[model samples]
Target: MKKSDFRYDLPTELIAQHPLAARSASRLLLLPPAPAPLEDRAVRDLPALLAPGDLLVFNDTRVIPARLFGRKATGGRVEVLVERVLDGNEARAQLGVSKPPAAGSELVLDDGTRVAVLGREGEFYRLRFESDEPLEKLLKRIGRMPLPPYMTREPDAADAERYQTVFARAPGAVAAPTAGLHFDEALLAALRARGVEFGHITLHVGAGTFQPMRAEEFKDHVMHSEWLNVGASLCERIRAAKARGGRVVAVGTTVVRALESSFRDGEVRPFAGDTRLFLFPGKRIRSVDALVTNFHLPESTLLMLVSAFAGYERVMAAYAHAVRERYRFFSYGDAMLVFPEREGGTDATAHDSRLH
Candidate 1:
């Protein structure tokens, strides 16, 4: 299919520039599997919508302040968005300049730290910073938040407080698991009180997510690899939950990708490595029975993922409904709870075929 098929006219006025006063206060659009219809609710009502034995899988990959503004040794302006922390003083980053920085070139950061381009790894460049502190400690003190492009503003004090999920722990991701942003401490407590079980996984989101689809055929579009890990303990929990006839609810598209990528044979197995798995229409989902996520950009990979979870027609209808009801869109906007519509025969296309 052509990329144009995914394009929709998203009004600029509906884009949310800032977060709501309360995280869980956002509206929720519920789209059940096919043979059923769509339902609209509030995020605060999540506890009542879920069953006691369902497995709620969350991405605990925390967002780090990865954006660094600096100038090259030649006095040229440069911006670096750290993709991953490889080692103590080494990391991979996307350096923005007229030409990519060559090896051995030095750039001065906003905090007066200097980083020398050490090497190149595919689309990303390796940089070795002059610091004795661990990458996390250095970034927390020096780096600015890597807010999404639509914000049109620099990361400030508020972003430090609002951009991360309440359960963030393993710090590595460059971007936030935005759908998880809606769950506050109280909301999580309510879910726990209802006996909803929780498990954790990690998938450090890459810069590819923010990249717009430039190809016509969706299959031609490629995704960058991101490191992920699904532990054995989590696998045991998921199997137990499934055996008990409970649904596996993925908190975001990242969790869905990680879980589905790790599945082997008839059971979900633990996996540790990089995955470039991409989900779109006609793909079969072996994992993630339900999804909780924010509305995504038109013609973006994230939109395709949601469309894959719910049928394309259902997603389009829900988006139309959201717009008519004046629901917010994107990172700082409202969320959707979509249950996969696979009640009919499976689609002919395997999940990997749509990855391209």
Candidate 2:
């Protein structure tokens, strides 16, 4: 499909600049399996929208403080956003500077730590830290949170906590799996009490997630790679859920990508590697039944994935309704509970069975 097919008109004011005071307080837009009316609800109502025995797969990859400011040995200022940590003291990063630094160039960070440029890797620069301390530890001391470009304000104290999900553990991501951000301890506990099962997969979101597609056609677009780990245990949990006639609900697009990447031979398998899986209209999503995700950017790959899972026209209409209702957009925004499109008309029986 053409990239323009996914475009939508969103007001500048609708892009969420800050997170809501409470995680579970954000609004939820329910897009039932098409040919139905979109319902406006709150994040707290998530437990009720799901049925017992459902498996909610979450991306537990934690966001790291990846943004850093430094100066070249020649005294030119440069900004660094670490894309991925390669080792204890080495990382691949995107540099913002007046001119691209040559290989072997040295940079002095604001904190006085030095980093040596190893070389370039596509759009990223590989650098090795001169400090005896690990790169991750150094980032904890001086790096700032990497907020989305849409937010004009600098990262503050609240962002340190609010930008991360409560269940975040494995730290590597420069961006959060935002759909997981809506669940607090209370809501998780509520879901557990309602007999829902939980599973986790790790997909460290890269800064490339925000990169715009320059290609007009989807076939010409090359997706950025992200590392993911889908364990055998989680695969078994998904199978058990399916066996029990329960839905496999993905918490975010990241989780959806991970699960789908791990799917092989009609079942999910253990996988630990980088994936460049791109989901767009016409691709069958066999790994997940329902999805919980935040509003995405216009003409973005994320939006195309949503349009693929639900019907393209239906998703566009729902997005229009969200705009009319003034639903918040992007990272720190509201969410949606979306079910996959069925072969026939709407699966009202399955929809009603879960909600009622």
Candidate 3:
């Protein structure tokens, strides 16, 4: 499919700048399997929308304070966004400055800590901290929250809490799994009381998630790689849920990607590695029966994934309805509950071939 196929018209004012006061207060748009009417509801209504035996899979990767400000030894100012921590004192990062620094260039942080540019890997630079302290500890002291570029204002103290999900524990992600952000401790307790089962996968969201698709055709695009771990325990839980006629509901796109990446010949197996899975129209998604995700940017890969899960026409129509209803868009925005698309007025069956 062409990249233009996923484009939509969104007003600038609709971009959400701040999170709602209450996490569960955000609106939820329900897109059931095709032919079912869409329902307008709130995040708090999620427990009622689901059944007793349903499984809700979540990405437990936590967001880190990965943005840092520093100066090149040449005296030029530079901003660094750590993409992934490689070791206790080394990381791969993207640098923003007037000019790209050569390999081996030294950078000085505001706190007088120094970092050495070891080398380059594609679009990221390998950086080694010169401190005896681990890089993670240094970030905690001076690094700022890495907010999405679409958010105009600077990250404030409130963002330290609001930008992270309540259940976040495994730390590594530079970006939050926004869909999971809607659930608070109270909401989670409510789901548990309703007999909903919870499963977790860790997919450390990379900064590359925000990169734009530079290719016109979807076939030519190369998806970004993100590290994920799908445990054997979660796979067994998913199988048990399916046996009981319960749905596997993914909390966010990250969960969907991780689960799908672990799926093998009619089974989900344990996996621990990097994945470059890309989902678009025509791909059969066998991992989850329903998806809970935030509104994505127009013409983005994320939008295309949701369109593939739901029908393309249906998703576009829903986006139009959301725009007309003044729904907020982007990272700090509202969410949708989407089910798989049926073909020829019947349920679509999974194909044998794996999708990349």
| Index of the highest-lDDT prediction | 2
Model 3: how far is 5 from its true place, Å? 1.1
- Across 85-198, the per-residue lDDT of candidate 1 in tens digits comes to 887689989888877778888999877888989888877899998887787788888788898888777777888879989899988888989989999999999989987999
Model 2 off-target regions past 4 Å? 343-349
TM-score of each: 0.93, 0.97, 0.95
What TM value does model 1 have?
A: 0.93
Q: For each candidate, what is the lDDT? A: 0.84, 0.91, 0.89
Give lDDT tens digits, candidate 3, residues 28-102.
998876666777888899988887888999999999999999899999999999999987599999999899989
Q: How many angstroms is residue 230 displaced in model 3 relative to the true structure, after the best TM-score fit?
A: 0.5
> Residue-pair clashes per candidate, as listed?
0, 0, 0
lDDT of 3 at 167: 88
**Model 1: ten consecutive residues of lowest lDDT:** 347-356
TM-score of predicted structure 2: 0.97
